[model samples]
Target: MAALRSREASGVPLAWLIEAVTAGFVDADVSTLLDEREERTARAALPPSFFGWLAAEARVAQAIVSDQNEGDSRVPYREVERAAARMLLEFAYRLMHDDPDRHFLDLPFRFAAPAARLGIESSLVIQAVRVTERRWVDQLLTAAGERAGDIAHSVLSASAAIYDAVVDSFVTDYVVAQAQLDGEMLATKRALIDALLKPGVRDAKGFDDLGIDLSGHHVAVVLWHPTAGIGPHLDTAARQIGMSAFANAVTVVPGDDRTLWIWLTFADDPPPAVLERVRSIPRDPGRVGVAIGPVARGVQGFRRSHLLAREYAAVAGRLPPGIAPDIADTERMSYLSLLLRDPERAEWFVATELGALATGAVSDRENRETLRLYLETGQSLADTAERLRIHRNTVVYRLKRIEQAIGRPIASRRHELYAAALLAHLLEQSES
Candidate 1:
């Protein structure tokens, strides 16, 4: 990139090129290339906001060249893309004026840092630049006519130099900014995560810098692989989850080589169907496990959601690789999560409350599930029978057996039995 800059510095100054292109040399009749009629035609061909239109076209072209449209549904210009396009347009117009910025080639530098922060690859910027250059060349050719050869030699040379300088600036800035992020931003994010986990730790400016809106609803998620390097898969999974939930924005923080903590922000809580879609990520390749927290609102929601996800992760992490659910969520696991917080006490409680019903025998498993459903359905035997697809008498028989194993009537300790049954089920799942 520096080589490109050095090469440009050694060539005809950009201001001189601009003077020659617009004012024309004494020998070349290039000034008359775009006569009044041709100018009107050119103006008619483009809308009033030609630069804006060109910027949008460049965005599309960049997306195609970057292969961002293949399976990804995100808009190409979602990042600091508009800024990049503006920089490109500014560069072109500056080339037509005599007083180009002393740091004209560094125009891309202003937007590059922000683009890099947004994870925009340098290649995409180069693609946009190439698109803008091509369009400019087409316009130049249309106006060239008989002076085509002279215009091509002079104007094309200047445009190529400008293109090279801008490309170098973007490439250079992205490299520096990304490197800085890898070192500094990682620590900053970790600090931010730590602060967010604690109560009453709010940094408005810091949250703004990281693009997190504390006022919006948030769903926290943790993705991990017990024995594999998460690598880029974590980011890809985060994107899939965000898109599925129709999140307005996503923020991901790498917790370690094997884990990523993510937050998806939305204007309001997504419907149940969207959450189901988020949970379906296990079907995708990579053997990644997702633990999602319930949707909550405001700063409290952000903190609560993340805390719940971490709790869910603790339980989900107990499952053997490939045995973890695609999505382990607080909605389904919060009760068990509380029980499992102290594994030893939880085990003793399960054993004592469930008695012989906690045994691994198939009969006991059936009895335990029947009792659990009986309690969950508001102690309605009919509802339990319907769910288990058994006759009401069968549910009655199971209840009797469950009571016999526990040495008490089911109604004597319904809530205790319910909690123990849930913990027993979780323990069974872990063992399996």
Candidate 2:
């Protein structure tokens, strides 16, 4: 029966098949889903590595059931936490069958033992499962595309049983495991972070315990590296930030193996030396990525600055390695990051705004630099020419070329032109 269902899924209409073949639909759905409150809650609970891990697990489960292979797929199980996750996912996939083999029913028990030892909270486990279920439903519906409305009910109906069984069994086992270990610290951190990030009243005592003064100015910084073993490096960088500012900073792991959330607090706005220290953090080994948010004051500022840091981090992740630091606190990046939340949209905007110059050829890049400098210097031809060490006629000539490519007078769409050119430069840098 499972085999028949799997075949039916694969043998869908051509359009459906086309949509299903690429993971882009799933990626898009996941991105959209992350914007929701519940998804954000779950995202906050897990580490930055969770999304990539979940995607890999989904692929492995799909491979197992579709191929009817009891043996493990190629996904790595080096981490015990992920090994437990894989087992539970496999059990869920099996339950989709009319007569699932009962042997794998003990999977929840297996997951509980290690989870308890690792001090994993039951609520977090449930939230993770719930988020995964959401993704699964979205993947099915997205693959259906135009037929999504037709199959949405059926997909939800079929997934309900699997989700319920998994949750019930997990909660039951987790209750038993909780008696054996204390995960109170993890729970406390999770609650504190939720309160800090979410909209509502906050407990001042919580901040007091962490030595964070809510009334002080804060500059949020997010540091992450591709590899998991960079925790020590991140710690060193965080300390350096505090030292450079001659102030205190609070750092949170946020449950991610590869990321750190930090807020450096000051009695006043950070001075030039502190900003310079932040800009130099990327020079550290391990290729650590740093995103520094603007300095702001009080509780609201703390939250807002962290949010901005997350946004900056998102934009930085897309840039080529060597240039991420150069964009930190740059006037152009601050302006462009606000508008480039969606990469696809950014690409389209760039393509439309800078027709010929967007091609990223040598001549195109030279013209983009000329235009950027020209705008940066208040549209002064002399200043731009001097910056480029070229004749003023050369600057004017390049402006004419830019105007021709954008099909408008530069002054008419100066803001759009500047944004598009800057973003295009970064995008091209990333491509390299």
Best by lDDT: 1
Query: Which pairs in model 2 have colliding backbones?
Result: 47-256
- In the range 1-432, model 1's lDDT, one tens digit per residue, is 353344347553333332223332132221122335433543443223443444454455556544643434443344434444444445445544422442333243455676667676677667767776777666555555565675565556556766777788778877888898787877887787677777986545466556677888888998887668776667778778777777888878887778899988888777888778888754453467788898998878888998899888878788654545556797656865788899889889988999888788999899988988999999998999999999999998888888888899888999999998877776777777
Q: TM-scores across all candidates? A: 0.55, 0.49
TM-score of 1: 0.55
Clashing pairs in 1: none
For model 1, what is the C-alpha lDDT against the true structure?
A: 0.68
Which ranges in model 2 have alpha carbons more than 4 Å from their true place?
1-187, 201-211, 226-229, 267-286, 330-332, 355-366, 377-395
Instruction: Give the Cα RMSD of candidate 2.
Output: 24.6
Q: Write the per-residue lDDT of candidate 2 for residues 315-427, one digit (tens) a residue.
A: 77776667565434534357657766776888899889888787757899999888878887989989999999999998888888888887889999888888887777777
lDDT of 2: 0.63
The residue-level lDDT of candidate 1 at 267 comes to 84
Over all chains combined, what TM-score does candidate 2 have? 0.49
